[model samples]
Target: MLMRIILTALPFLSLATASKDTCEWPSWQDALTTCHGPPSTYTVKASNGKGLGLFSAHDLDVGEIVMRETPPLKISPPEIVKGSGYPMPAVTKLVRKEFDTLSSAVQDEIMSLTYHITSSKEATMDKLGIIFRTNAYNSGKDIGLFPKIARINHSCRPNASYYWSDKLNKRIVYATRKIKKGEEVYVSYIPLLLTQEGRQKLLDRYGFKCSCDACAQERAAQDVSDERRTTIQKAFADFEPQLTLEPPRTKKARQQARKNAKASLQLTELVHQEGLADYFAKAYRVAAISHARVKDWKVAAIWANKGYELKYIEDPDSPYTMEMHNLTSNFIANWESELQVGQ
Candidate 1:
């Protein structure tokens, strides 16, 4: 009876070990399953200028969740900082931990996996900092999940947006614009709708020269957009002093505030329509402020909510999202308070 029991257990143990062995380093398939089937219909292959990049295997629509991946290794912020100087030791430790946790087959797969490493002090620091700075997938947190999505190159006018869903325990990339078959999907590593100089500085920090269509066009349109945004901002600012001046609140000041607010909204909407979601938050904020000046709390709240939603879509727990939530809540509360006072 004992011998019979041991024979039965042997197959189960063998199967378990085999499962581990097969999953050693983990493939895209493994990550997909782990994340409950994120709408990833792409594969990574070598590209000429960019290193390995994700190419669409089929047509992908806007808002479609593309790659859903778990970090290969999740580390804390301190751990990341410690590993910054010489990460091989930390990498080895992490790899060993992963290997030990995984089945033998997975361990073998991981052992064979290749990682890009830098040896020089300047190069290594630069590389590590870039990784830290450009790492938008997880917001530079020490989360052990590295996804192929991180390798996607940047574009000023990006076709995709990434969101880290804590509920799903995975980082999800969504197409903000339609992607054609064989198109290389990209997301802006930095906010692109800023001034040309600001965008260029960010690109330089990321160690890449951006030649995206939007970047090219922005050189010509930069002055125009800046002038428009500045004019709108100034008009909005001018309304404040009028609001405090004298008793019977003049209609001219109110009208001017409304006009300024409307103009700002139009410019902001134009930016959004131009695929400048990166700057939508700021534009939305300007609209919200204008609406607030006109005492149109509803419109103010709505724009605030829109900005909140966009921030939530980009980064759920970001400071921007929290601010939006607070602003919206206060608006509602104040409205209700005013209603009670009138009654």
Candidate 2:
């Protein structure tokens, strides 16, 4: 059953890159062209109350790969000068090296599109850091890339989950839950389940005040979600000891662990449906580990594959996927052997 879900998801993942020829890339191009003065094939539209957002010109479904964009510029952390301080001579030298590497046309485009930070103490040095900080998406392995997806303003509860696909060499955002036409797709800039204080702090730091539906939910629902998540965390913490304990673990203990893990998995699904993809990966990981401990390789393989799939969406060719692939292979081999013995 778990294998079936993974297999089904592969097709959806492929759709992210489906030909724009059929879906109408011109509208997207026009939108990007209008917004940034670039003739790129991504469109910007009013995302209802969410301000400006990026969306497909054609219909996009769950798991479909969206546009893949390479960052116009790349900056390493060391290359960045901290605080509002002036760039040391060394920093200037590195910036020049990076600037010199780009083609003149690309250089012209970047300089044209660049926006400077107004208040940096080291105005020139801080400008670059601010841009990268706002624009760069971690493509796993500490690599950061830029894409139009970064333009989409965040919601406390987001409609979509963005992953960096290493295999496809693009950042892909998928719907954690179904979306309809004309909906403003959103991604969470911060963890969705954080306490209100934590959520507000993150929002302020990111330069946006979130007024998304989940953030606006009645106090009752919010409290319920908080309580459920707390319970899930406590159950997971409790189960960890038994996982390390020497067996002949009692049947009751094992059953209870599985039950708790299942509840957590269900809660994660609810959160996903509520537009929280950031938590989905962690929730799936817990369930996978619990299933493995119970010797349910099939379910373990499924959840393990889910984690890999989500990671792949964010970073294709990631170490995470490679490790999961190996685990899945081992599980399948073991399953085959067990089948033979039963026969």
Instruction: Give the best candidate by lDDT.
Output: 1
RMSD of each: 15.3, 7.3
lDDT score of residue 105 within candidate 2 = 80
1-343, model 1: which lDDT tens digit per residue? 4333332533422232244334321333342212365555787787567666777776766445567776654555334455454354454454445446656664443333323333454454423333433342343554443546666777777878776666666677766677887888888777554655667787775666666766566545757654544554454455444432122257886777778678767857676656665566667766766776776666766676666656644554568778876765555555455556777
Worst 10 residues of 1 by lDDT: 25-34
**Span of ten consecutive residues with least summed lDDT in model 2:** 28-37
TM-score of 2: 0.66
For residue 99, model 1's alpha carbon misses the true position, in angstroms, by 7.8
Highest TM-score: give the candidate number: 2
Residue-wise C-alpha lDDT for candidate 2, range 1-343, written one tens digit per residue: 5434444544423332343123323322332100222233246776766556866544544444445565655544344446744344554454456767878886654443323344455465644445445556666444453536666667766657766555545555555555555566677777555655567787775555567776677899877666655554565566556443132377887777667557656755665555456666666666666666666666766776676566544444457656655655565555555556777
* TM-score to true structure, per model: 0.58, 0.66
lDDT of model 1, residue 318: 65
